[model samples]
Target: MLFLLILFLGGPAVLTSGRVWPLYGTPRKTVTLSSYGGHVFQEEGVWNYSTMLLREDMDVLILGARETIFALDLNNITNKKAMVKWEVIPDTQEICSLKGKTKETECQNYIRILHKMSDGRMYVCGTNAFNPTCDYMSYTHGNLSLESKHLEGKGKCPFDPFQRSTSEFVDGELYSATTLNFLGSEPVMMRSLNDSIRTEFSRSWLSEPSFIGMKHVAEGQKNPEGDDDKIYLFFSEAGLEYDSYKKMDVSRVARVCKGDLGGQRTLQKKWTSFLKARLDCPVSQTKLPFLIQDVFLYCPGDWSTCVFYGVFTPQTDMLQYSAVCTYRIQDIRDVFSKSKFKAMDSSSSRWVTYNGDVPEPRPGACINNNARQKKFFKSLDLPDKTLQFVKDKLLMDQAVEPSSKEPLLVKKGAAFTSIVVASTTALDGSIHQVMFIGTASGSVLKAVNYDEETVITEEVQLFAHSVPVKILRLSTTMGQLYAGSDVAAVQMPLSSCDHYTSCMDCVLARDPFCGWDLISNSCVAINSIQPDTHSEVVQSLRDGKASRCPAVESSTTIKFFYPGNMVSLLCEPGSNLAQVQWHVNGHPVENSNVYQIQHNTLLILKASDSDTGHYNCTSVETIKGVDYMTQSATYELRLGDFMTDPSVQPLVQEHQNTLLALKVLVIILTLMLLALVAWNFYKGYFAIPKCFNSDEESQQKTSGCQKPLQTGGRNSAASKACSSNSNNNHNRLSGNQHNGDQVF
Candidate 1:
């Protein structure tokens, strides 16, 4: 009875089964710059989105193009009125062309710097036709307009639009690290306080530096005697301390005191507290090390706990691969404060650590109360010897390693151009950080950082064309992402919850913003939850645990033929990480002539009566050291005699039976027609005589009449008399025959 119940409930089994289809990542929404009227065109030059800034308070995003700036509203990106465009003047074009620059390509203004000031205005800078320029932008009454006032942006901006540079606004001043000349041969790190206190041209300061970014690090409030606000600049420059034999480009992280003023006498209007250190990002197995490409600062709460995420690539092939590493703010401070300074010893002709007599106050220390009370109030009070020592001793002897020791992400096939990170709480209430990396192919990859490893959650195509994404900005307050490419700027939501329909898909996505809502039976963004409403939501971004998902019951069944029949069972596992297993009659499958496994399918060759049983396919996955198993629909296989069993009969057998019946009917009709012909011949209905053959009786009677005729001569009288007697006998015979006929 139990077997019959299992058979009835399990239903018929299928001949072929395999794993389920996998789900690919896609974007939920995408808005291009053209949709918001932010795209601009130039007849002689090309325009590209090179820089981006997000304004969470006003719900608008700012994008920088070649000679143009666009402001797009985040709420309605398609509205034309919600966007604004501002273009720089073309007065420097002829001057740049006369200086041997390409008019159609390089001799055009390219907006590079867009720093928001503490006031309501913004400081904008551009490479105006190979002559760097800066201007003030005012945003009042919800309208962005450029001011007529302009400043010489020599050290504060790069003359070439394609040159890499970075700038930051600190204490109503702009500190930038960029090339200062039109030829792009001179690189300098300058402090622009009304453009008078900038660094003078000197080889000891900066040697062809390609700056990535500048970050402002403030002192911790808990430490009363801690350092002042320090502005750190990350870049790569040509190593000058070493000779030509050992000359190579080295990655560096330099820091400057925000309170530093110009020196008193000899080194006037120069940075008196400038220092730098080496940043190492080497390959583990090869000599190809990672060159710094870009950097982003993530400060969650405290300055000491801040992290710096940097993108690096090899110089050999720019389009092949890239890597991302993280550095803690404390580690950087340690390298800057405790590491020894590198100096060139002329006598030895080699670079070595400084071991000379030290000054009373540190050369690169910020001006504090002790120095102020001693009449050393500012950088101007510092001596020329101390300033010169700091100028030549910028590079640190020790190198700073990344916090993770290894890269957080190593992307292949496409080079990474920009990166931004965000954090979210998982179901376990633990914070998880997710990194959004932009590629040169105009795609954004979302990766989650877990305890064991980093898992790529999804990839989104941000642009219709394969243009490089130059800038990426994330708004954690609004949960939106802004990407800028050469062709256009795009805005999209960070989490695409609608793409994940089921609990399994939502959990496996590993996206902290997505959760499976039990009340609605759909995946939804956690940020969309109402403040007062309460609902059952499950998020497993860290561990990808799907224990809360409801069990799925399947009722589908399949059946196949028996005896020398081949059968294949398909079981869809749904996930690429899952392993498929086959079970027959509630027992695990074994390799034999009757059963063969092919990927997610089970093949049975020459099926017999013993092979008849229930078959099931299960998928097993291991996530965070825990096993998860899911079973597919049950299938029942039955074997019976091909000749007698109706269940095992095929449709072709019915056709064969009909053909056999037609042959039998034809044979019966032919036999009946032959019997009718034989009966007609027996009854002489088609013949002329009743006797069909002449026998010896008739021949003997003819011979007897001839013998009397031959003796006729001697018996002529006898013949005549016999004739008379015969006539009488004939009459008597006729009378007897007539009587016999009458009696009958």
Candidate 2:
């Protein structure tokens, strides 16, 4: 009786099943990250390797591990590189521990610098038991050698093991931004080697800054009038303008001219052209400000068109949301060159703009041909008043804006840590910028800036567990992405063509790196072609329409299910973003109780004569308000009349006996309920009905509160009726045929 009641009312188990379905934003490919090239540190000892340098020329990745150095093979196909250790003395380690330092974790040497010099050598440095030191090193063909002598590394390297520091070499000078003290309180930007110059200690100069990245820009090449090159630094620090009770963090971009020589008298050995401005990336709906975490510079030979992409995250919100904002090189120039200065010593307490008359030749401007023509070419020749005014006035009044005045991409529940972009050319001779963003959840999202919006195409897992991605580098020539974490460094292909097998799947992916080849009838990379302009390849990135695929009929398969068994027809659509459509007898599915679409499978509750027909499945994609479809699978379902055969008598009789038992059980329960009601009435538990229809009571009908049972019997009045469904299914099913004879 319980089973029959559930079936008559449509059981919830059939309506809701424990199945996970593929939806939009699902990645087409998933592969675990692998680590290799470890002979010294082993697998379990590989820690503090979040920073690395890719030497593509040598086909190796230079790493700075804890008290050790290694060079892993490029592409990671075969691990072969140098593996060496650089440790401190036992007496030094004991002294470090006595001064309230950790012996196992913090007191050991941690190599933090692996900078490439103008000459073919590496300038390496390490925190030797809290006393930093530096030396010159050489690596070639799995061999390593360090200089016999080490030098003092005060401003070139940070005293702390994990302090945020960035350094690069330009014109044979090492320009570094790091701390100067053991406690990491003194932040400085200095250029060492060949007349070293450093920034003076002032609250207005740096203000508790945490530097992220620094890049050298070639500003002289784009100017018709001669000018010097520049070095731009991106960081986040406490806001100096906003008045709030809590700490407010804001992003900043500081710039210094490469040819900036120190001032003469008032500000000797100090940069005169050091200026910084605010970076704004605000989400309008949430009104949350995102702070910059990392920046990548893309300059394809010209400085004017160079663009900088930065990864940003919220200040204090617990959410894992992130945003990507872009700034053109030209827009940054306008803010620094045209905007007024924020006076460091204003009369009022608040930060005020300077409205006084500016000095001639622009005190904080790089020396150009115009300045030379006016007899003001060198920093040493500048006036004392001009140098003194620029000493404290380094902040600009205007803030730099993004290319579209908004974030290019805003993703929720994923904190982006690093980003790298590559310019790709499609088959239609159009260029698109593909960005590979690394998240804190150890995954990489592949997105493209199309028209004015961003579309995320694919997501690939680069690590087995949830770990933060500290470094991400793109190799356009090799077509791969190399990601780095504290314990692993893995390589992933930029284009995964093997996931898509059919033509429709290849086009629907909308990936610029992959396309469908009509000649071979398989998906392949765009670069695999000879000239890269093939007529057989098909790619619809703008619309993602799959109707362009040529018509090819799939082989028809005959399927027969027993009288009372569940049937499922699976449809194979390669992409998760596609919409699957199912039709029966060349018409749409009509009945809900019989047919259901779940997890790309068409399910039938109980197969019978009424469920027999020809079924077809196709994949549809929508783009720009138009639908494109291509056939993928087809099936013919037939229910054989097994009741007419003598061998099937036992099964049919068993099904009938179960139904009879349910009816008998329902009658017994009804009698017990009547006896209880009579006793309740005698004890005056409730009042009886006072009025009723006389004619209705005389005709003996079933009570309105009683539920009617549903049975699938051929002798029932509804089943024997000659309706439209019977006319359509009469021609396909035979009277006395069984499936066992036709198909095993």
Candidate 3:
């Protein structure tokens, strides 16, 4: 019984709890960049792993390779004529090669940033063979061509292609957080408009920051006294003020005002609106902090309800796991407004909180009407003391915490690389958010949140090769997901409704984009149905109740077998969370040496006449507090004699025929042997000598073949007697021969 319990619990049963439920099939459509002329260089080491941008209105995808940029048609990606490519000049290649860098790998222009300006033109930046440069790409007459005007790209793009950087373009201005030096030692957050305004954090403010993402959020306030738009940047940096023995890296969320100009006479041509705070995403069970990898913004309807989903991993690489945490916009705002200020105390040589009075216009506040009322219309008009205070108080003491202490999804064995989110409206008019997380293995995990529990519905392999996914873009208008990798980019549909073949599969998927259609008996996309006619759609994803599914009746199958034969019966319960039970003749079957149960299979070893009976299998499932039972078709097993069974009649006949054929072969060989013996006798093969008589051998035995002398000596003794006996013997032989001739 213990062995049976172990097998039942640890067998090949699907786990529908915290683990991922594998999808039956992949997406229907997949478009790779190689199908078009995206990478025509065709070199061994060159890669197209740059970021990707989707223009849904234009129905095109824009991506950058090493020195080229490609625009692909989204509808028909394979149509090469609809594609366009632009290759930047390689004039600075020789200069970059002389910089002691790897010419083959590093000393090449790598296109990294592509942002569309407020005008029709696009702003592009590249490493430019280690000499960073930026250019404008004009789109006119259905063609994209590079302009002659070149701008310095030190603060706009990173000097290394492998460096982590982020940029966003808003209102003809570019805001970016990137490394500006060749060695990637100097990290800066800069804004470039008519004039570039750059700021580098002091060691006390930021230490070795690695930027991940940047987003421009607009505050939807029409009041003239309200603040303007703001740009938030997310990064992870080494902590310098932590009172610990070892150094630690902390995740940070920073914000900057959109309208702040450079301060005059104090911090010229530099940002005066930079303020950052720590971001906390802690595991409740382990109490270990996680480092942020990537962040995605989920804004369905209003900006106030927007949430940021961040992918985090342990600071140390010893733990091979990842987690996802969500933060509301309101929580982030509260942290920035109410957090204390941290400043270095030179007297004690340690960091301490500043309890001094704050400046009038609160450091890092957006330029509002209040600033204008105080005769400070721009950052240049602010006092020198105000600018110094803002710079010194850049680091906030309070950390921004996630909404839940527990993570939304904690995945083991894979590190998340990118993330995107979408929302769907259920029949109850509630909005549910679904997250699609990309991993380092070029696969995507689809998960949904049911109250507080996050369940993984499916995992899809987006690339044939296991290259890391560099970028992931979601298009709500086209209902597609675009993933970029080192070799190619693939476009797949957001929801694969047709993959679900049955009502149970459709409901169990818990996909917001899919629902069961009773008319077609298939899973269909919610968007495909008309707005007013979807009342009959069955959408019980949360409960997973299969009551609406039609029950199938299976017929009894009778099987015959001889005694001592092994029998196996298969039982399919259909659901992953079900327990299978086997019964023989309406009595429960117990596990023993002769009877074994493996998953949904019942094995009967060395079956006998007593084992002949009706076998049935039942499946029991417990969801919430209710139990549902389903039964399989009955199996009739009968035992019979091996020789009398009708099924063994042909085999018995075959054995008899084989035995008769063997007997006939033996008889034919014996007859042939007899014939050979008779032939040898007729050919005189067994002839014997007539003088070799037994009595002569005893009386006149000679020494060898030459017996003349011995015979003479024996003859002298009985010459007279022998002569008389020989005459009688001759007469007797003549009489016998005459008698034999008369008989013949």
Candidate 4:
């Protein structure tokens, strides 16, 4: 049965272990840059923020753009930045133009790589008019200087600006996954400078891949066997593993050992420790598969326990849906080290799990202490049979499952493009992971990821329009996030504490960066508070409860208006998560035509004699299975008919036995007036007037019937003439009767 299903899917099923993602989400607050006071950096002609590097030690954010590189101050990005400019020469532009590429867009230097070298220098690269090149750069005294010579960057940098690639400088060597040709046909994962190990030139190895990012991982002191460090690449590639109805791309994570130096003869110049596995992040109960767009690696302390936070979107463009899934290092390691190998059946041409005898010592096992004990210290020492076996069985049968068996966050209406995670210690002494996700719409969603449930605290909008988030960086120590788009780069604090002015708002925001300070009686940044007053600060990140806030007397806003006037009582709420309710004379405000609540505003349809009372507005918010209610606002609706001396006690805040007000009264009065008019019209209270028209007697005006418009002098004369004709006709009929003359 498993083989049949695998053949039907066109490839072996990688979704053996998976779970569902919830469709519901919390109400998140939206903030704009103009209102939130975020610092922005946009040089006169600088655009296309392709790459960003945050150096907390130097207190600056380095940005890479088209033909330019900028080093903006972390304190305030609006300040002038240290810059280095690189442009494509005329000869290079001409050569690029002759290749059938757009001279204006493709024939230019687009800075793509900004890697830090081991010696504290910078390694930067650009697509120099379809020709990639690299240079060493130095930053000193808030300025940038470049090395005299440049290196060929065909493998180090992508030939095109839009192609996705990942590279890092590890231990004075470069490990990269990118396309090497001018047309970007070849995709290779290689290690250079110290080793010449690369992937085999076969479709089974890559199959048209789009690389996301790469991370170097060593088992650290926690490893018992001291395994060789590995570089893992995250990407999405076409489902060449299947022969389905439509071309579907699957997310993948591939590993390559640092010590691999290719094989002696069987797979010469190719890595012997190359293996790939699928990353299963199926969204919703329908089991819709999502393609990975970006990944952020979070390591608490040891490299062995690193976490990969991946942002995904569905291949179907029906909805702009996105999700963030988390994968642990141990889960990925187990799949490659212990999971079964996926292989193609020779007779059926269907991909299936291999049940044959496994190669001894493992085909792609790194040279750990176990292998070293057996005298296999490197890839060159491995037998030809192991190398040939690994080359054909590059894919593992089992996939790497997510940590929680579900996505950390799932959202609709926004296509998430990049992400950065931060671990924060809230006032409750509990650690929480805050994920800052950048969207294609140029907004950042700050989502608090619980173990199984997720809540979005807020959304900060950076650009006024849609601009893809090309670069996103986070500085944990500074509590700031840097986001770059096609237009500019923006630096924003992790939280807007000032936006939550009240104690209830601060606590209910569920923001780990903000807390309600009892000493100052205001919402403040947690880091800005004094250490001595740490206990005085209140924060509840788990459920965002305001139960710790002391009760206060809500000020009554007295509003006096004339009778028959409409009064709108507004309830300004602090948090979007709470529901607003209004009360009149101490009872729940019944929603009638006369009394309406719209967009948190209470409207008294028309202030009348009986509309004199007080209106109280309250907010009820649920946090961690507990409901917390607070009086947000109060209003005294005093009609002119009830205004009296101030010494007298006012009316109650809410009214009981509430009935429909002005609208009902008006409807009854209108009906009575219409009935009386109809009865009198049929009874002829005044003397009835009859008038006739030659066109139609039924169309003439008369007081006994439904009257038409009363015309003046001309109609009166016509009525008199018609009366005379009737009288003469009656007289002639009497004379004819007297004369016994029968007229038919």
Residue 88, candidate 2: how far off, in angstroms?
3.6
User: Per-residue alpha-carbon lDDT of model 3 for 1-744, expressed as tens digits?
Assistant: 233223324321111133341221222122233331122212244476557767665677766778766676665444332323434345566667777777766777778888877676778888877778888886555566888567899988888877889999988888988987888878999998576887755775558998999988775355445677778899998766554455567788998878777788877887787888888775533333568888998877566777899998776666677778899888887777677788888888666788998887777776778887888878888888878887877888877877875567777766788899988777556778888888887777778878766767667676654677778888888777777777767666777778776675566556778888888888888878777768767776567566776564545877677677788888876455557878899999889988999877889988888888899887665444555554466888877657666667779999999999999999999999999988887898866444455665545433212122345566555664655666787799899999999999
lDDT tens digits, residues 1-744, model 4? 334334544233333235444433444577787667789888887778879877776787778999998888888988756888889999999999999889988899999988887777888889998899999988898798878467888888999988999897888888999998997889999887667668887888998899998988876346788788889899998866665656668899999888788888888988899999988885653233578888999998788769999999876676566888999998999999999998878898767889888786799988888888888887888888888889898899888888987677778777889999998777656777889898888888888865466888888888755687777888988878888888988988877788776787678777888899988899988767777888899987766667789874577887776777788888865556767888888889878978988898988888787888888888777777786664467877775544352323244212221344656788999999999988998898746545454435455443223322465687767666766766787798799897885544
lDDT of 1 by residue, 1-744 (tens): 233223323221111113121221222223343332232222234368777766666666666787677666765444322324444356668778888888987887788998888776778888888878888886567677888567888988899888899988877888998887878887877888564455557665677778888999886355456457888899887766544443356677888888777788856777777777777664433242457878889988878778999887765552355677899988987887677777888898767788776564666777765666667877888877777777777667777777976676665656778888888865556787888888777777787777746767766777654787788888888777777777777777777777665676677667788888888889887767654433488777667788998865654575756688788778877455667878887899978867888888889988887878899887766667876664466777766556655554665688899999999999999999999999998898876432323464344342232224345566776656656765787789899999999999
> Could you tell me every candidate's TM-score relative to the true structure?
0.71, 0.76, 0.74, 0.81
Model 4's TM-score against the true structure: 0.81
| Per-candidate RMSD, Å | 20.8, 25.8, 14.5, 16.4
The residue-level lDDT of candidate 1 at 364 comes to: 77
Clashes of 1: 20
TM-score of 3: 0.74
The runs of at least 3 residues in candidate 2 whose Cα sits more than 4 Å from the true structure, single-residue gaps closed, are 1-42, 344-347, 551-573, 580-619, 629-744
1 or 2: which has the higher TM-score? 2
lDDT of 3 at 744: 100
For each candidate in the order shown, give its overall lDDT on alpha carbons.
Answer: 0.71, 0.75, 0.72, 0.80
Candidate closer to the true structure by TM-score (higher is better), 1 or 4: 4
